[model samples]
Target: MATHAVRVSGLVRSFGDRNVLDGLDLAIAPGEFVAILGRSGSGKSTLLKAVAGLDYDVTGDGDIAVAGEIAVAFQDSRLLPWLRVVDNVELGVRPGRGTAALAEVGLEGRERAWPSELSGGEQQRVALARCLVREPRVLLADEPFGALDALTRIRMHDLLRELCAKHQPAVLLVTHDVDEAIELADRVVVLHEGRIGLDVPAHDADRTHLLRALGIGVAA
Candidate 1:
């Protein structure tokens, strides 16, 4: 059996009168790639944030053990205007460890360029690089490619898969696009009504069944 990287049981979170997450349970193995799909306001992002330790208000009797550090990449690039592309990517690194980090993201030569000078895709690449530089044990991504065009998004997906294969981090991605989840994740988990609606492996048959269960039509 694989060792669990993150475990959640009976997790609950409430905002005033509304319950965002109620009795949620999830278990993730090390180096697993899991994608979370949900409608708007289903607390998908909330769950990720809580697991990432960004939300302390959550109440749950769960065990989350990350052997390494955790890093997150938000929808926005979140780059500093004053810093160059490489510098932004290096922000997660120590003072002298920037070069190698930038190199890992394939931004070796563009380090000196400013964020504004790069395209949206390049900026997001820098953001991804920043997260990678941390060498995190778990990578939490919240719609990281939401802002890119179709071609760019596909390219980014490939890059992300390559990077994860190389680095071997447990990845949890929250995305609305079902195809994106199918293309990128080894498993797809659907969050509905503050609980896991479906959890299945990404094999051809299973993926088709899961998508149909989610009311998503498979490509004919």
Candidate 2:
């Protein structure tokens, strides 16, 4: 068995003259949660897309490996408007699995609700249910909770931690929020010019150091 749920070697991606990812390498242990922090256009999403095998036109000079199924959740819930909530979760999974997945995300009785009827947080929950229903080995969450309000984001964070513990899938969360990364990730890496500039365990993450690395000044 592979020791890592996801691996990238010598990864490089470019658009026109700019290289978004230049020889970046990363490894995610099975069941470990990692968060990535970077400035806008720092290639955080690009790296996640590469791991999910969703990169095409810009992918160059890299190898990505995964031990099992990979699922992705974006800032947008991306649920099908026409499908009932349960049906959305069941899209790529077995018919009966949606109910269990929805239950896991605290939306058990909402299986019949329409996407239009769900609140923003509820829609994101449905999105998570859809991803978790696949029993994925790796879950790539690209600012999954970025759209939620502060209180809802906090709730979603706790829910995500619980779900990840239960499912034991390696997770890669890309976000701009430093506090969010500290709260959720076992490890956090700051991406600079497509390469990892600072990698540290979240529990001991230095706020000033992280902020400085992102080219932001700490108000000392």
Candidate 3:
């Protein structure tokens, strides 16, 4: 059996004239959280999609291997507007499991709430619940809290950390925010020009270093 929960070897992805991910390689251990950061159009999202198996149709030479189950959460909640909170979480899940998932995300009493009635943060919670209900062994998150207010984002971060600890799923979080990456990930990776430019433990990374890795000027 493979030792890593997720692995990408010799990965290459391109869009017409631009090679978004060129000969990229990444490995994620079980229950480890790795945050991705890069400048705009640096293939951050593209890399996540490739790992999540959404790039199956795209022509690529690399190989991806995953262990157990996979679940994804995007910046947009993507909940069906017509479905109630419980119904959305219950998608493809057994009856009554949605309530338990909601409770896990701190939305216990809001099972009957409509998607329209939820605030942005609450909606994201439901999205998280949807992913958690699957009992995934790998969780792919793409800027999952990017739309929330600062306080709400902090709260969601705490909740997410707790859930990941309990679930112990290897996590790949794609984000542009440096602080967010440092706050959540065991390791921080900066994708530059289609490859991993920097990979370091989060505890050893700082804002200025990360900014420089992304080719941004920092005032000294």
Candidate 4:
């Protein structure tokens, strides 16, 4: 069995007496790609924030430790408009790692281009390259492709899968699109009402079964 890259037990989070995560427990193995699915206000993003140590009010019994640093990609590209693409990617690199990271994301020739000059997909690629430059042990993405159009989103999904495979980071993606999750993740975890409602492998049959379990009708 693969060793766990992240473990959570009894995790609880609240905002003004309204609990968002209640006793959530999960274990993510190294090199695994996991997708988190949930409706609005289901605490999916909150969970990622807590794991990344960006949320200070979370209380949990388990610890999340990565073999290396953790990197996050948010819904927005979060690129610096004043800087060129390569420069933005370089921000996350230690000293001499930016070029390699950009190359890894297939942005070798576009390094000098400004964010405004690139397509939305390309900008998102830049954001991903920034995260990749960190050589993270874990990649936490919160709706990273949410704002893109359908075609662009699909392309980004493929890029993300290829990059994660190449880099071998344990990935946790928060998305509302079930089909996207099924296609990209090794495992799909559904968060409902502040708890884990379903956890299953992402095999075709298993994804169908999970959808059924969640009372979401699968297409005929």
Which numbered prediction scores highest in TM-score against the true structure?
2
The candidate with the higher lDDT, 3 or 4, is 3
| lDDT of candidate 3 over 24-131, digit per residue (tens) | 999999989999999998889998899888976666678889998999999999999999999999998888899989999999899999999999999999999999
Deviation from truth (RMSD, Å), model 3: 1.1
Candidates 1 and 4 compared: the better one by lDDT is 4
C-alpha root-mean-square deviation, each candidate: 2.5, 0.8, 1.1, 2.3
TM-score, predicted candidate 3 vs. hidden true structure: 0.97
- Residues 3-67, candidate 4: write the lDDT tens digits: 78888777888887778988889888889999999878888998999888898865444455555
For residue 201, give model 4's deviation from the true position in Å.
Answer: 0.6
**In model 2, which regions exceed 4 Å deviation?**
none
What clash count goes with each model? 0, 0, 0, 0
Cα lDDT computed for each candidate against the true fold: 0.83, 0.93, 0.93, 0.85
Candidate 4 colliding pairs: none
Residue-wise C-alpha lDDT for candidate 2, range 1-220, written one tens digit per residue: 6799998999999998899999999999999999999999999999998888888787488788899999999999999999999999999776988998999999989999999999999999999999999989999999999889999999999999999999989999999999999899999999999899999999999888889999998887
**Tens-digit lDDT track for model 1 on 1-220?**
3477777778777777777888888988899999998888888898899889887765544445555688999999999999987778767567655667667666778878999998998888888888887878889999999999999998899899989999888999999888888889988998887889888886652656666766667888
Candidate rank order under TM-score: 2, 3, 4, 1
TM-score of 1: 0.89
